[model samples]
Target: MLRIATCQMTSGPDIGANVQIAESLIRKAAREGANLALLPEMFTIMSNDPKDVLRLAEQYQDGPVQRIMSGLAKSLGIWIAAGTMPLKTDDPHRVTNTMLVYDAFGQEAARYDKIHLFSYEGQQERYDESELYVGGHKTVSFNLPLENGLDIRIGLAVCYDLRFPQLFRRQSGIDCFLLPAAFTTNTGKAHWEVLLRARAIENLSYVVSAAQAGRSSCGRAFWGHSCAV
Candidate 1:
C-alpha cells in the first residue's frame, strides 16, 4: 500500500514564513515514509487585497517558490502535489490557481490550473475569483509507477472545483484525485466532507485533500478536516 499524507496548514500573508511552515511539514511527511504528500491551497499567501496575488504571481517556469518545492521534493525523494499557487498567465492583472506536480528528482511532471472560479455573496461575505484569477483551459493528470508494475493515474483539482463533479468525470483513467482547498468555515461545515466523499465514491478513485484550517490573518476562517477517502 502506498503511504500518503496531506498537510492542513494555516497560511498567512508572509511568503517566507509560509514556505518555512511548508518545509517543516514536508520533512515530517517524508520522515513518516509517505510516498506522496499534499499541501493546502494558497499555501503561500492569502490576502484580502487581490492586488497581492498579482504582486506575488511568478512566471510559469522559474521562481523562488518553484525552486524551493522542486528542491524539497528531490531531497526527500517523494512525489509532491503542491496544491494551488498563483501563476502568471497571459492576462496582465490576473493569475492562475495552479497545482504543480514534481517527481522524486525535482522534475516537474504536470501542472493543472483550476478551471472553476468561485463566487459567493452573503450578509457579511462576498468573493468572486474572476476579479483576480484566470480560469484554466484543460484537465490535468499524471501517472505514477508503483512498486508492483502498477501505474496509478492521478488527477488534479483545486478548492472550488470540488463543487463540479463533471470536471472530474471528464478525466478518464485516473485512479486517484488530489484536491487542495481553503474552504470557508460556513461552507465547510455544510458541504466540505459531503462533497469530497461524493466525488471519491462517484469516481471510484482515492481522494487526498489538504486544507487550510483555522483563522487566517486576512480575517477569513477555514474549516480544516483534511482527510483521504
Candidate 2:
C-alpha cells in the first residue's frame, strides 16, 4: 500500500508565512515516510478581500508558489499535490484556482483548474467566488508510478467540486481522487465525511482529502478534517 498524508493547517493573508508553514509540514510528513503529501485548498492565503487574491495571483508556470513546490518535491523525494493557488488569467477581474502536481523529481506532472466555483448565501455567511474566479471546463487525471513498478490513476477535484458527483463520473478507472477543501464549519460538519464516503462508494475508489481547519482572516471558521482511504 502507498502511504498518503493529508496536511491540515491554518492559512492567512500572508503568502510567505503560509508557505513557510506548508513547507515545514511537508518536511515533517516526508520524515515520517509519507510517499505523497496533499496540501489543503487555499493553503497559502485566507483573505477576506477579493483584491488580496487578485494581488497574489501568479502566472501559470513562472510563479514563486509553483517554483517552490517543484523544488520541494524534488528535494524531499515525494509527490506533492499542491492544493490550490491563484493563477492569473486574461480577465483582470478574476483568477483561476488551480492545483499543480509535482512528481518526485520535481517536474510538473499535471494541472487542474477547479471547474466548480462556489457561491453560497446564508444567514450568517455570504460568498460569491464567481466574482473572483473563472470556472474551469475540463476534467484532469494523471498516472502515478509506484515504487513497485505499478502505476495508479489519480483524478483531481477542488473544494466545491465535491458536491457534484457527475464530475467524478466522467473519469473512468480512477484509482483515487485527490481532493483539497476549505469547507465552512457548518457544511463540513454535516456533509464532509458523508460526501467523501459517498463519492468513494460511488466510484469504488479511494479518496484522499486535505483541508483547512481554522478560521479565515475574516474569522469565518473552516471545517478541517483531513483524511485518506
Candidate 3:
C-alpha cells in the first residue's frame, strides 16, 4: 500500500508564515516515510478581504508558492498534492482556485481548477466564492508511478467540487482521490465526513482530504480533521 499524508492548517493573512508552516508539515510527512503529501485548501492565505486574494494571486509558473512546492517535492523525493491556490486568470477581476501536483522530480504533474464555487447563506455564516473565483470546466487526473513498479491513477479535486458526485464520476478509473478543502464550521459539521465516506464507498477508491482547521485570521472557523479513508 502507498503511504500518504494529509496536512491540516489554520492559515492566516500572512502568506509567508503560511508557507513556512506548510513546508514544515511536508517535511514531517516525508520524514514519516509518506510517498505523497496533501495540503489543505488555501494553505497559502485565508483573508477576510477579497482584494487580498486578488493581490496575491500568481501565474501558474511564476508564483513563489509553486517554486516552494516544487523544491520541496524534489528534495523530499515524493509527490505533493498542493492545496488550492489563487491563480491569475485572463479576467483581472477573477482568479481560479487551482490544485497543482508535483512529481518526485519536482516537475508539474497535473493541475485541476475547482469546478463548483461554494455559495452559502445561513444564520451564522455567509460566503460567496464565485465572487472571486472562476469555475473550471474539465476533469483532471494522472498516473503516479510508485517504487513498487505500480501505477496508481489519482484524481484531483478541491473543496466545493467534493459536493458534486458527477465530478468524481467523470474520473473513471482513478485509484484514489485527493480533496483539499477549507470548509465552514456550520456546513462541515453537517456534511463533511458523511460526504467523504460516501464518495469513497461509491467510487471504490481510497479518499484522502486535507482541510483548514480551527479559526483563521479572518475570524472564520473551519472543521479541520484531515484524514484518509
lDDT of each: 0.91, 0.92, 0.92
Candidates 1 and 3, the one with greater lDDT = 3
Ranking by lDDT: 3, 2, 1
The TM-score between candidate 2 and the true structure equals 0.98
Pitting candidate 1 against candidate 2, the one with the higher lDDT is: 2
Give per-residue lDDT, candidate 2, residue 52. Answer: 90
Q: Report the Cα lDDT for residue 197, model 3.
A: 95
lDDT of model number 1 = 0.91
Cα lDDT tens digits, model 3, 155-189, are 98898788899889878999999999999888889
- Tens digit of per-residue lDDT, candidate 2, span 1-229: 5788899978989899999999998899899999889999989778998999999999999989899999999999999999999999999999999999999999999999999998888899998889899889999999999878999999999989999999999999999999999999989999999999989999999999999997777587999989875
Error of 3 at 97 (Å): 0.4
Q: Which ranges in model 2 have alpha carbons more than 4 Å from their true place?
A: none
